[model samples]
Structure formats: structure tokens, C-alpha cells
Target: MSEPQTEQGKSAMSEIQIPEMTGKVLACVDDSVYAEAVCDYAAWTAGRMNTQLSLLHVLDKNEGTTAQNLSGSLGLGAQENLMQELAELDQQRSKLEMEKGKLMLQAAMLRVEEKGIVNAESRQRHGELVDTLIELEPETRILVVGKRGADTESAHGHIGSHLESIIRALHKPILIAQQSFAPPKQIMIAYDGSATMRKGIHIAAASPFGRGIPHHVVMVGADTDVARAQLQEATDVMTKAGFEVTGAIIPGDADIALAEYQERENIDLMVMGAYGHSRIRQLILGSTTTAMIKRTKISLLVLR
Candidate 1:
């Protein structure tokens, strides 16, 4: 016979039994400036895809460790008392953070509802953001997140530390929201002839996210015959997919050239491959992908 279920085991089983809500536009929310934008973009996406919007707030385990650290420095009997006090304090702090997350998720739900997502849902999980996202991946249609979180809000030009990890961890398409939201009027694809970028092109072609938006397939390199050919191929794919396609070849670095084209054409969203180069090459020469993510003022739709 099977062993009798413990309370904890029963709780875990209940969690597992919760129905997977597939085709949700999952937006990660926090006490950050970008949280509102995340909601807005997610609402737009959900509306476009005719799906539900789900907001997630993760209370990172690494946060609130100061109490524990302070308890570690105490000595003997005082240390024991301090440890107990610290443990209680840590518990209180965790509770407060979770409450704060609940409020944040409520506000996000309201924001998205105002944008026409009526049946939005909110969830709060205690763990690393990446791990929470990974567990929720099966239910997610597309993951939307802000470029920076509350912890990294003032650190201009740097993405949230977990941003890259979340991108690498999940297979679903990620929409990285900018500081503000604007309904996309035009979108630019930073296309290269690489297999990764080709896959991105196909994803863009099929996705409802950019349907009916004029697409600019911008390739940054020497305006060589090969570059022209590659640009044409990308544009042709998008055109065949029913987008109004415009192909261009600009001579400059990828990040700089793409940003320039975006501003020049007033592009609202950028679609591109997430990390086309090897980690070793990226470390040695720096990553155009990271630079573009940092520099772009518009929202990004990053495909793996």
C-alpha cells in the first residue's frame, strides 16, 4: 500500500493539481517603474492574441538576508537569543514582502483591466524569479517583463540581473518592456543571415504580435551584394507572411545602426534573436545583443 500523505505532501499535490492555464500572456510585476509598462504591453499582447493576462510577482529568496547576517556575528547565549529574534524578524519581513507583492499584483491587474483585459489573474510566488518563471512556463504563451526591476531601477543602462537568466531559462518568447508603453505602429527586425535570426524571422512572421504592423528588416554591415541578398531574403519571408515589409542595409555596428534606424523610422517594437554568439565570443568582444537591449528606447520582442 502507498504511504499515508503528510500535510506537506497533500499541499504539494494540490498545487500540482491546479489546472495549467495555457495561452496566457504572463507578465512579471514588481515594485518597479517598469511594472506599469509591463502590464500595458502585456495587456496589448493579450488583447491582440485574444488570450488571458496573468501577472506574477516573485519574492526572491536572496532578499531579506540582512537579519540572518547580523545574527551570525553574535556570540554565545546572546547569539542564541539574537538568532531567535532574527528568525522572527526575517519571518515578519518575508510576510510584509509577500503582502507588498500582493498589492503590486492587484495594481497590475487593475492596470491591465483598464487596458481591456477583463479576466486577468495574479499570482505571488516565493523563490528566485527565474525558477518561478520556469515552473510557470508550460502555462505561458508569451512572457512579458520589464527591462529593470525595483532593485536595479536607478542603475541606468543595465538590465535587471535576472533578465538574462530568465531569457536563457525559458523557451517561450519574451517581450522586454521599455520604461513606458506605446502601441506598436511599426516594428524593426535586426536581421542577420544566421540560423537563429532566421528562426526569429519565422516566429515574427507567424506571431499575431506584429501582424498588420509594417516591418523593417534592417541589416547592419557593409552594403555588399551578400548583405543585400540576405536583407531581401528576410523581407521576402516577412512579406510572404503578409507583413508590409521594407528591407534596408545600413553600414555601422548592429546596436548603433539598429537604434538609429528605429529612431529614424519611428519604430515602436524590435524583434531579434536573443543571443546569437557563443558566450566566449560575447565575453571577449562584448555582445551586440546586450548592447541593443540596453540602448533601445522601444520595447523588444526577443526570440530564442
Candidate 2:
């Protein structure tokens, strides 16, 4: 009888364990201003999920590939000899670059650990950023990146170039970091009643991610009866799950209304669906997901 009771306790413990999220949250870090925020959010997520964290920095050589142009003039044989020597010098330079990458990883790890994320790890590699993410996809539960990366210019009038591609590629949620870190107390949802947006709501309410945190579901429209009905229906779902819920219809366009609501209500984090339209379609019609992300400075928890 004692053995059976002991077994029942173990079974109950197993039953209560977190079901989703198979791996660590991998945050792609670079020297850009966004990297620190990425680390901060990664630590927060890892703490929330009771999971591990991994920080990765890719050299991304393809973006700025260039060949050496040796300056000094020399006789033909001497030039060939110098080229060989330069080849050796290039090898040394590559080694140094790898060392620098390691140093960056070490520093990022310290930042995370200092933030109380004890299970954090770091990786340094040389490859296309997208390719590196694809290779590491199997071991990743979530992906985190900056809205604007180091090459922020190329992404003018849009989300980060790498960010757009990564969202399109990954099946997991992506957290877009802002300039600084603040542990979010209130999460505002850009609910459109789409399957993906609903999934984001369910994840926040059911999973360990936002337990006890307040939620506000904001739908953008002209404030008609139909809009209020839709907002109430979604709010009911979250409320039934025991999340403190606030449902409202904000008047304006999607991007503008969301920005105003977040500002007015002091929303700490924004959650919404992503990439619902085709690239060609967005090019002609404009993407609300991209536009909204670009407008806000707070962290966004984007769902697919």
C-alpha cells in the first residue's frame, strides 16, 4: 500500500509537468543595440518557462564579403610570393575573428546568468544567419531577434531583413526585442480572431509563459456591434482560463490604434499574429504585421 501511494504521487507530478516547449529559447545576438534586449528577454522567457537559454552570434560573412587588395607594387615572382604570404595572413585573421566571436559569446552568457538565468549557453559560428537558424531549428522551442539588426538601413520601411525571412521560415514563436528590457506585467493582444492569433492567446493563458499576468485583448475596427461581439468572445476564452482579461475595441487603423492603446494603457508587451499575407500581396497591399512591429518600441511576442 505504501509503494502504491508513492507511485501515485510520482504520477501526479509527471501529469502536472509542462507539455509543450521541447527545447531552449535560442536568441540570436550581434553587436547591434538590440542584442542586449534580446538577451534580457531570453532570460525572462527562460525563467518563465523553466527552460534553458542559448545565445548565438553568427559572423554572417556573406553580407560583407570582400577580397584583400594588397597595395604594394612588386616584381612578378615577388608578387606571387607575397600572395602566398597573404594567404597565410588571412588564415591568421580568420583565427582572430573566431576568437572575437567567442569573447562576445562569453559576455552574453554573463549578462544572462547575471539576470538569474542559470541554464544559459552560448554559441559562435560563421555562416548565413538564416542558414544557421535552419540548422538549429530542431533544438529550438522559440526564436528571439531584434526588430532592427546591425544592418538596420536595408530594412528601412520594413522589419529587419533577416527578421522577415526568419519569421517566414520558422514554425516557432519569435519575440522581437526593443531598445531596453522591462519585465512585462501587462500583455496586450492584437486579436483578429485568426487561428494564429487565437493560438497566441491560448499559449499565453494555458502555458507557463504568462500565468498570473494580466491580459488585454484589443481589436481594431470602427467600434460596431460585430466588433464588440468578436472581442467579447475572445475575452471569454481567456477569462474562463482564469487570466484577468480586458476586452475592448480601439478606433483607428490597426497599426495606429494599437500604438495608441499601448501608449494609453501602458502595455508592456504586445502579442500578435505574423506573416498571414503573401510577400507579393503585402508588397502591393502593405503588411499590418510588419507595419505594426515597426511602429512600436515595446517587445512583441509574434506568432505564426
Candidate 3:
């Protein structure tokens, strides 16, 4: 993941290399088609990294006050009976869904096991999704989430609705899985002149994602000597660190250009800051951290 030079068409220096990662990976699942896809993708990735896989399912109870309102709308006696029925039904449904999800996860675990991944395990919890995921062993290398969760029906929707809060709360790297993907042999790293981006370059230089993969470093802004200098500094850092960096200086709306670069390059993943320029606006719009969850179709590593 070393940064390279482009102004004079010179190549960046290469540095020491590390072995491929085979650490613990967490894959969040629910009773949805997307969950199944995520598990499959996770298994494939985990197998490649030679890492253990943890299949996590968080049973969220905050579906809102719809059930409460329905219970109270009925007469006192009838309300009690209706509430009881609804509660039982909800529990039953959740149980059934969990059962199906577990079966799906087990199937994925078996696939990974075939590849000699011996530490495959599964866990189910009845609590908030974000809180539960963070509770997992902090040594977990990556958290793999789907681009859209089971609750989303539109392309622009946030599948993992809690992603914003989770990104802000957790200090780890996140990989947002797109609809369908082969292993990302080519990844695009969005390099803005920010401390977060600095850390991102370091991570790319050191993490499993950047190992043996092509990394493209892109700076989105109006072309100018100042912009070039800023990007050059980043490129220098990465180049010194022994990363294979590709340089780009593009012009357009920031978000739009980013998304476009991802598509144009056929990028499989995007690593960038979650709450830099969009921090204030993001908190109000559930934050820029979460907005990316709704907008992109590639895996994202939101560094804090």
C-alpha cells in the first residue's frame, strides 16, 4: 500500500512486506437474502485471509411503538389478550428467523472449514446490533457488513441502519459488503489531506486488504499546485512506507466524484474518513459516516 509518484511519472519506493492475514473476522447476519450473501462473501474472504470467522446475529427489539399502540387501542381485557398474542407471535417469528439464519451461517462456516479454517463459530444475541458487534473480541480484524441490510428495499437505502452510530462508536475498521463481489484484487483508497487519511494509508500499507492487492490513491478537488502539493505529501508518506500507490487528482463534487471513481475503476472497496468534512452535517443526517453507508456499493473502511 505504499504511495507512488505521478507528477514526473516516477515510481514510488517499495518496502517490507508482511504475511497474509488469518485473524478473526466478524460477519453480522440477520434473516435476509443480503445476510446470506454477506456470509458467503465473508467466508470467502476469511478463507483467503486464513482467519477464523464469527457469525453474529443481533436480535433488535426496538421496532418502535407500533405494537404498543395496537395493544392500547383494544379494550383493557382484549388488549391484554391481544398483547400477549402479539408478544408470543413476535417471539415465535424471531425464533424462526434465527433458526433459519443460523442454518445459513452454519452452511457458510462449513464452507470455510473445508478450507481449513478451524476457528469458525456462531453467536446470537437479543440486543442492539452495534452494541453487540462492538462487544465481540476487540482483536477482531474486520467487521463485514452488507451494503444494504434486510430492512432496505431501495438502492439508496441504508441496509445496516445502525452503521453510522457503530462507525462513530467503534475504533476498528469496517468493510461494507456490496451486493455481489469477487475478492477485491483492486481497491480504491480515497486520500484526502486529513489525519484520518494518514492513518488510512498506514492501515492500507499494513492490513490484509492492502496485502498483495493494487491500491489506487485518489485526491478529489480542484486541480492546483496547492492540491498537488497536499496530495504529493500523502504520496510520499505511502511511497516511503512501501505501498503500491496509483495517483489521481480529479475535479467534481466530492461525493459524486468519489462514487464515480469507484465505479469507473471497478473498485471493490473504498477506504476513507467517515467524519471529516461531513462530521457536523453527518450527525444531523445521522452523520456523513452513515451517509456513505446509504450511498456506496463497495466495501468501506471508516477509520476514526
Candidate 4:
């Protein structure tokens, strides 16, 4: 973990008036296969909103500290030599990682620029991923991140370890990119009439993010009259906002129903309120937000 930023440092960061930091669509990229998708989705969003795009790559501190506590059972002089050699090796590895990050960022920049995003910029930082994103939260309008990282590529049905932490740490809207990108022709808003979901609906209605796209307001539960009424209320908000809206009250588990509806409707993006329950509660009884994130194949736009 990195040290917390000092008040003075925070103030300095606030004062640094970079034009790109204001309302920029920030995308976090790594060497994972989803990095290209993240860049592409971010480029599409930035283009739609007419905002600047920024790419961020965070180098985890633990990734560079593999030499610690490895000098076991060696003669004192030999141990010292080995420790020195390991230190040099660590330095070389850190340098290589830094160079690799630069190349990745360069490639991402070129990719977005090719998509007609000329104002795109990139940054490389050192620290944990969630911490880095929290520090940059002030500058971010919409944050784009991959569902899984390179470390978790083979682990099917598991989201990146940093994903939940990022959701918990930042208040900004996050877009979790899948393995591919396509412009969203239709979007589904997972609504359950909770305060958080209501806020999400309001944000979606007020913003131009998905203004002209067709919308599906889906609720998972028995198709009771009350459920229909709630779904209608939610869809009405979007309909009044000039969106072509369709409301559905499906049956079954929340995550399963939403995922099924999304696929059946060919929804390109699913927007929902993220983690409405407490962390401890979610730990005891699994989170639908996390489950949906893992289950769905399409990208998600999650609001806090």
C-alpha cells in the first residue's frame, strides 16, 4: 500500500489546473486482453460526450518486491552478496515494468486516436489500483476499467480482485469493460426502486450519456401489480427524458433475470446501482452487483 497523501499534497493536486483533468473520461489499462476494450469503450464515451480521454496504468508496489525474505540459510557473506544481486535484479525488473507500462499507454493512446479521439492523454502511477483511482477521482467523469486483469485471465467467473475495492472506494461512475467493444444500440437499466437505483435512474435521465439510445428498465421479482407500477415509474422518468423506453418485471433471481433480459434484448450495456448493501452484509449474503458483473458478457455502467 502507498502512504496516504498529505493535506498539502492534496491541495497541490487540486491546484494543478490541467485542462484534461476536468470531466475527462479516464480509462485504466493494463496488459490484460480487456485493455483494448476499455480503451475502445472509453473512446466511444469520450466522443459521445465530447470530453477528453485519459488512460491510467498503476504499478502495484507488491509486483516489484519479490526479493524480500529470500536470503534464508546462507552464509553471512554469501547472503550479503545474494541480497545485493537481488536488489540489482529488482531494480532491473522495476525498470522493465515501467518501460512496459509506457509502451502499453502509447499503444492505447494510438488506438483511441485512431478512433478519432485526438485529445486523449495517458498517465503512469505507482501504488495500488484503488488508491490511484481515488486520487484521480476528482478529475474523472466516467471511469473505465477491465472486468479482470492479466493475473486473473484464466480464472473464469471471477472479477478482478481490485474491482470491488475500486467500487467501494470511489464515488464516480465506473464502466466495466468486457473482452470486446461495440457501440451500444440499446441499454438496460436494472431498477429495483431502491434509493440508489432511483438515483441511478435520475442520473441516467438527466445526463446525455445514453440520451438517444433505446432503454429497457428491468426489475426482477414476481410480476405483481406493484412491481409493474414501480417499473412503469422508472421507465416513465426515462420516457419523459425523450428516450424510447420499455419496462419489464421479470421473474427469478435478480442477477439471473437481469442477465437473461440483457442477452434476450441484445442490450449492449447494462446500467445499475452498485453495491447497495454494506460490505459485511454482502460478505454474509452475496452481492447481486458482483454476481451480475461476473455473469454478464456485455459491458456494465455502474453508478454509486
Candidate 5:
């Protein structure tokens, strides 16, 4: 009788487990509309994982005062005798920049808490954005950033170099919020049967990040024999980790399949490797990774 009750309680707990996303989630906010959307995505994800959210804004001194000083010394300065006037101009610019940074940071914090997550906070940082995020990677379980930057010039191509740096530098998973997303309905795992993908699957299945979430394991391409074997292997992995897994053999390019599947199935997140086929191979085919990053509208969880 006691055993049955214990089992019942355990099952009940699993149903309400949310995402088991403990620890703090670090979200980078900038002056873009997408930044606040990113914060919303972070709060929703944090609420699902039952985690705290930390909003970060980097002042980027290189883009501000230091750059001006270096430029003035490098002959961009006026040849007129108003050296004192130039210095005063620099001082005013610096003050305005600092005030703008504070306003942006405060706004992001308010948005995060507006969703009622209860653990949202903000931090204003100075220096390179990617460097600061990487510095806090040990304590950060997940890093959230906007898919495209606030600046229209920077938003067009691939996600800016800063996002690329954060993705490559840190081992923690990153969630890129596109448009906007609430709680995930059904999530997709990009299981390629590679060692890194295997690690990603294990993390999703066993970690709190996947609590109570239904997942579809997609094996892309036409290797019937290999795909079958890999699918079975993934099944065993998830089974051992105690997950309800549904899988499919998707034909065509992995990138195309990912985007289409997200739209069709409403996959809230796509979990896959940042780079696969070893470090050397990853360097060779890194553009495919970038292509996928630009193409998807749903959130992505990229593991190193």
C-alpha cells in the first residue's frame, strides 16, 4: 500500500515538474524590440524550468569613449586650437552613453518580471558582450539572446559576430528567441546519432530542461540502415533516461527539415549540436550551422 502511494506521488510530481530548469538563466538585452521579446522568451523558459533570469546589458566601452580618444589621437581630431572644446564634447557623449545604458537595462528587468517569474533581476555590464557572458558560463545553465540584433544594419545577415562568439566560446546551451514564444508545446531534438547529438539527447532527456515536455527525435537524410540504427539507439538512450519519445526519419536537407517541421508541428525548441563531426570537421562545415541559425523561427538549444 505504501509502495503504491509512493509511486503515485512520484508520477504526480513528474506531471507538474515544469522544465526542471534550476539555476539562473542569463539574457542579453540591447536597444532592439527583439531584446524585450528575448526577455519574454527567457522568462517563459525560466518559468517552465522554475529558474531565475538575469538580464545583462554590456556598455561596450570600445564602441564609446575609448574609441573616440583613440580616433582623436589618430588625426581625426580638429586641427583648430579648440582642444578643450573637443574634450568637453567627449565628456558629454560619455555621460549620455552611460545614461542610455542604464535606461535599457532597467527596461529589460521590468519586462522579465512583468511575466511574474519572481526571480528575474538585471545587471549592467561594460566591455565586450560575448566575453561577459562567457565569464559567467559556470553559473549560467542557459544563455538567451535575440535571434537578430536591434540594429537594422546588423540584423540582416547572420546573427552578429557577438552571438557567434558566445555560442562558440561557452559550452552552456543557448536559446535564440525568434518573433516570440510562450511555453513550448512539443519540442524537437536534432538527433544525428553523432556523439555530440547523443550528449544533447541525454541532456534533454535527463536534465531538468526537458521536464514534462514531449519530444520528437528527427533523424534527417536517406541512410535507411544507419537511420534505423541511430533511431533505435536514441530510443534506448531516452528510455533509459525516462522519457516518452516519438521519432521519425526525415528526408532531404537537415536545415530545410528543421524549419518546415517547426512550422508544421509547432516545435517550440530545436536542440542540436553547435558543431559536429569533430572540431576539424566543424570548422569545415560551419556555414551549415550559420544557415540553420538564420532560417529557424522557433527557439534553438545549441549544445557544444
Candidate 6:
């Protein structure tokens, strides 16, 4: 029903303001292809939500490049001195890694500034990334991360396979940043009328986040009266909240249908329920979700 965004959206979203429920936008940054996109999207989100932006870089325990060995030919006293030197060297290495993490944050911070995010700060932490995020989860409104990373410099490739774990662990929403960063003007809610999908609808409607962006509530299957009514109800909820809403009931496999619509309509972002579906649907939906995050062209905003 609705098409992609037009100039009408630009006028309404500037009035957006964050409510008390969510806090600042937290974006994970590292030396990877996804890092830049992540920062840009985070800035876009921070701008819309009227929240501060935080850049987090964690120095994992094994995120070291160089290795060291002790001299085997040394005498006992010489060995003791060598061990002391080695221990100090380890400390120095840790210090250098901390500095490196800080630099990465600094660079990410600068990148987002170009996107109009002025209230941004960077933090560096030691230990595991998941552990740090778990500790920081409560303070974050939404988490933004790269789907795949070539972070040869850090410990994360697909955030070291911790993306799923992070999604599973945190109650907060996560934005799986894709390769390109164009500020989302149009949003499509991949809906099934499920609880989590409904929750995503309510959040998107109630929050100032996707407010001016036109939302297409799309479902896959035969366009039945039931599908029509379900989508109509969802559309009404969004419409009342000031969102430009429309409905689509496309027939086919869910993933394939949504993917085709995304390309055809030039959708920038897709919001959907996280971990919502039956056993059979979960099997079908899980792979589709993974594909969307890992391989799709659009950025995904997942709600738990």
C-alpha cells in the first residue's frame, strides 16, 4: 500500500524525543568493515532518539598479536631476571592493547560526528566483550553491532560468534548493522501477529525511534481475510501513533517474500520479533533471520 519514504518523513522525525524507558544508543566498534556502518547507523539512531551515543571497544584476553619466549640457555639467576622482564613485558603489552582500543574508539567517535551526533563518548574495557556488554546492558537503550567483521585487529569476527549470544542474553534491542549506512527512511516490520512481533509494533509505535518513517507490516502466506485483519489491526496501532502505516500480505515463503519486497521497495531497515515462532517456524524462521542478519542488504532492528 505505502511506498518508500518521501520528503514528508524528513519533516516529522525531527520532532522525535526519547522517552524514559530507553537510554543512550551503544555501538560496538573495532577495526572491521562493519565498524563504519555501525557508527553511522548508531549516529542516525542517536539523532532520532534524542539520546547520547556511546562507542565501546573491549580488549579481549587473547587479543594480542606478538608472542614472547624465555631464553632456555640462561643460568638460574639469569632465568629469574628474564622471568621478571617477561612479566613486565606482558604488562606493557596489556597497556599497549588498552591504548589501541582507545584509539579505535576515538576513530569511531570521529566518524559518527560526521553523521551529526554531537553527544558521543567512547569507552575501553578489558576482558571479554560479552561480559562487558552484559554489565553495560542495563544502561543501553539499543545495541548496534556489525553482522560480520574482518576485525583481524581485534577478537571479533561476527563479533567472535558472540552476536547470537548477545541477542540471547540481553533484553534490550540490537541493531545488526549491515555494510551500508543510509539513514533509514522507510521501515518494514516483518510481522506474523505474534506476541514479539506485536511487541515490536508497540515499541516502534510508542517510541520516537521510527516515527515519521513509513512502516510496511508485511506477512507471508495466502492473503486471507485473517491475514488482512491482522495486518489492519497492526496498521491501526501504528497509524494512531503518528506513523505512516501500510499493510502487505504477500504469498510465498516468509524469507523469500520479505527479501523480494525489500529489494523492490528499497527498504532501509526491517524490524521484527526476536526469538518468536513455533518449533517448525523457528526452524524455518531462524535460518531466515540468520540470513537476514548475515547476508541481507538492509539493516535489522531486532526487538526482544
Local distance difference test, per candidate? 0.81, 0.79, 0.67, 0.84, 0.72, 0.76
lDDT for residue 72 in candidate 4, whole number 0-100: 63
Which predicted model would earn the best lDDT? 4
- Output the worst ten-in-a-row residue range by lDDT, candidate 2: 1-10
TM-score of 5: 0.82
- Summarize candidate 3's per-residue lDDT along 71-151 as a digit string, tens digits: 557788998888888788777777776677678667767755665667879887877787787777375777777766667
Task: Name every residue pair that clashes in candidate 4.
Answer: none
Q: Which stretches of candidate 5 lie over 4 Å from their true place?
A: 1-22, 65-83, 152-154, 239-242, 277-284
**Per-candidate TM vs. native?**
0.88, 0.85, 0.78, 0.91, 0.82, 0.81
Residue 111 CA displacement from its true place in model 3, Å:
4.1
Better of 3 and 5 by lDDT: 5
- What value of lDDT does candidate 6 attain over all alpha carbons? 0.76
Clashes of each: 0, 0, 12, 0, 1, 1
Q: What is the lDDT of residue 45 in candidate 5?
A: 69
lDDT of 6 at 156: 32
Give the per-residue lDDT digits (tens) of candidate 5, residues 1-304: 0011233432332343323334688888888757867888888768767778888888776544432334355454453435556667767887787788789888877777688977677888778777888788877878888877765425654676577677778887898777665777788887776556665666676776777778888877775665666676677667677777788877777788877877888788888777554457667755456677888877788887
When sorted by lDDT, best at the front, the candidate numbers are 4, 1, 2, 6, 5, 3
Ranking by TM-score: 4, 1, 2, 5, 6, 3
Model 3 alpha-carbon miss at residue 32, Å: 2.7
Note the residue pairs that clash in candidate 5. 21-49
Task: Provide the global lDDT of candidate 3 against the true structure.
Answer: 0.67
RMSD of each: 11.9, 9.6, 5.7, 8.8, 8.5, 7.6
Candidate scoring better on TM-score of 1 and 2: 1
| Local accuracy of candidate 1 as per-residue lDDT tens digits, 51-150 | 8888998999967766655555667789888878888888888888888889988888888878888999889888888989999988898999999999
- Which scores greater on lDDT, model 4 or model 5? 4
The CA lDDT at 303 in model 6 is: 80
Judged by whole-model lDDT over C-alpha atoms, candidate 1 comes out at 0.81
Clashing pairs in 2: none
